[model samples]
Target chain A: MSTEPPALSADRRREVRRQALSVGAATGAYGISFGALSVASGLSVWQTQALSLLLFSGGSQFAVVGVLGAGGSGVAAVLTSTLLGVRNGLYALQTSRFLGVTGVRRLAAAQITIDESTAVGVAQPERPAQRIGFWLTGIAVFIGWNVMTLVGALVGNAIGDPRTYGLDAAAAAAFAALLWPRLRSGDAAATAVLAVFVALVTSPLLPPGVPVILAALAAVVVGLRRGGRHEAPPTSRAGELPGADPVP
Target chain B: MTTWTTVLLACAAAYALKLAGYLVPATWVEGERRSRVIALLPVALLAGLVTVQTVVGDGGSLVLDARAAALAVAVGLLLLRANFLVVVAGAALTAGLLRAVGWG
Candidate 1:
């Protein structure tokens, strides 16, 4: 196996940054909705801003606020939100392989392995592109999201009722933006349906974040059933599905 | 619950989970099965989130509120392959209209 880092041109790095910037812009806009809702859900501006800066995961932030709005316990809200954010682990693992990072670089890489970073990294044409894409997207999303959160919080405060202006819809709309392009296959569709079903069934019974965790479990089950014939594969290159490009 | 306390605890828990990814060894995460499962994780998590938000929003009630209409419009736009900004704007517009019509 080739352990050496692939050569990357300056143009490639720039391209990666451009891609990251677009994704970041979209994600950042979405964070505005989260900030608005978080405050509207009874969190102080300081609390909402802190969560945006500290947690930095949009889905988990929504889950936390959803639980809070429902009057659930703090422990329950935290637990649920934490569970939903667990996918970052998978992103970190995939990104670590491409970045070939260690020590401080490795730690930083892991910190930035969010959805946009992982997607951009995985979508790159080469390993070097992957590393650049990951870092660029991660940093971009972090910076853009925080700034947008501040904007949203200020607007939400000014507007009073966020629902009156349909601000809450932005989160779902942003997620839809992220999700639509990825649904390219039947298996993905099935997994999505199963997840939605699981969430729908469990939401009423569970606290805010737990339903997402359960949906993830359902997807895992589906994946295990479908891909059970072989051991899991290493990170596939962008534009290549599993079993599409076999390494010699 | 003390709002600040809730926020603090939630933030701490979230950071802990994010940090946990680095703590777990890579060896445990390797394999085709594991990769497939990981690939599906985001969709599953998001689906659950959407489901929860749509079905049992505030007050534990499942009403055909503005949020639902906005989500439906967003989903339609997504299916139609609209640009991300366009999709968001479409959903927001639908929601605003619904609210303006007193359906929200």
Candidate 2:
């Protein structure tokens, strides 16, 4: 990676900012559902808002609420969320090469280094736009997510019964949509099926969050037996080319 | 521990992992097999989550209820290539309607 960034044209810069902001806005809008769900799942409004502000990663935040909502222990909630958050670390691996920062800037980058930011960052041909895409998207998402989370949390607090509105089903559907795009290859699909089966079989036998954690072993089994052909890391596939597809 | 404790701890762990990626050398984690497993981990976890969320109920009982019907609707929408919000809303409406009609 070159330290000297190629000069970006005004039109190119404008295009990159537009892409980043739109991605951020769409993702942040989705945070409303998370806020409502977290409250319905037994977290206080402050707690839910705190999650959006600090945890920031959509999948990990969802996992925490999901696990806790199912009556799992705090340890299980933390473990499941942490497992989902691991991909952000991997995304950071790619973004670090393009985003060479230090001290306060480096800390800020690490905080916002999520799927959306990394995806938008790497999609750019030039380094300058890449930096803009990453920062603007990250900051936009952070603000939008927190604000929307507060609104949803207030609404959720007012709702009498979450089941009446089918929030539980909405949560399930959210996870399904998130998992749907990842099931392209046969090995990945097989692993998903196996994981689902394991979770179902163990749901009654084990605790709530424990089954999901145990189900992760399917990846190890499948990955070892079947080699991955896709050269680009899986995170790149999660990029939102248009605003329609929202990636967590 | 309290909910606040869990929330704080979880956020810390998640941020720490993200920071670790930026701080650590690429050589430490760059391996084909390792990355493949890491990549597939979320797929497995999310699938498991969908199953649990759809079918499993309080006390970890397997209860095929309106949630199952909602999940079916969600799968159908996904097949139709509906966006994320549409799929979620459709599933919620399905479940809510089914429950309203005196069905599980």
Candidate 3:
């Protein structure tokens, strides 16, 4: 991966900036729902707010809420969420190649090396704009998301008995929305269905949360059986484009 | 509370995972069959989560509750390619409305 792509003309720079801000705004506004939902899931305002600040990965954050909201053990919730965050490791591999970052800067890049930043960075044809896009989107989303998290938390704090308004259904709905796009291939669908079956069968016998962890075994089994189809060629399938993972 | 302790430890663990991805040599993690399994975990986890949230409840058994109906609505909206916000609001509305009618 080359670090010096090419010079960015004035138009290209402006175009990159606009793209960065737009991605930032969209991803940032999403933070509001996460903040609200985390609180709605029974996390304290401070704790919810702290999660946004610390964990910062939207999908993992949502997994945490979804599991705990259902009375899951902390271990199950954390393990499930951590499993989802593994993709970040892949994104990091991609980012480290082209970003050419080193020392503390590289470490910081690792910290914010999420989907949007990696996507924006990789999308750029020019090296400078790539770095710029990555940092711009990353920092912008960070500021916007944290601020909106406060707003959503305050709003969530005002609501009562989330169950009364059917807000308790939120965790389930969010998961369904997230799962919709991932069922692209027969294997993925089968894995998902099998996971569902495993959880359902185990739900009665196992304690809360354990079944969800057990369900993850479905993917491991299927992935092993599926063999070498590592990443579906980006164009060949429509399933795994961004925003499919329900961040909220 | 114990929850906070778990939250804190989880946060640290999550951060450690992120950092380790950077610190570990690429050869060890890249192109391994194990990576494929890790990649698919989110899809599996999310599907399991949907099942739990929709059918399973605090009692740890499957039940056809308002959450299930709302999830059906969400599935419909998502298949229609509705925006994320709309999907979320629609599901919440469906559940809220059903509960208002005493089904929840």
Best candidate (score: TM-score): 2
The predicted structure with the larger TM-score, 2 or 3, is 2
* Model 1 Cα RMSD, 1 decimal: 5.5
Worst 10 residues of 2 chain A by lDDT: A236-245
Q: What overall lDDT goes with each candidate model?
A: 0.69, 0.86, 0.77
In candidate 3, the residue pairs with backbone N, CA or C atoms under 3 Å apart (3 or more residues apart, or in different chains) clash, namely none
> TM-score of the candidate numbered 2?
0.94
Per-residue lDDT tens digits for candidate 2, residues A33-151, read 88888898999999998898888898888889988888888998999899988888988888899898888998899989888888788888888999999999899988888888898
Candidate that scores best on DockQ: 2
How are the candidates ranked when ordered by lDDT, highest leading? 2, 3, 1
Q: Give the per-residue lDDT digits (tens) of candidate 2, residues B8-70.
A: 999999999989989999887777778778888989999989999989988899999999999
Report, in order, each candidate's fnat: 0.57, 0.81, 0.64
DockQ of each: 0.52, 0.84, 0.69
Runs in model 2 deviating more than 4 A are A1-4, A226-247
How far residue A12's Cα lies from its native spot in candidate 2, in Å, is: 0.7
lDDT accuracy of residue B37 in candidate 1: 73
TM-score of chain A of each: 0.72, 0.92, 0.89
Clash count, one per candidate? 5, 1, 0
Off by over 4 Å in 3: A1-6, A226-233, A236-248
Q: Which 10 successive residues of model 1 chain B have the least lDDT summed?
A: B54-63
Q: Per-model i-RMS in Å? A: 3.8, 0.9, 1.5
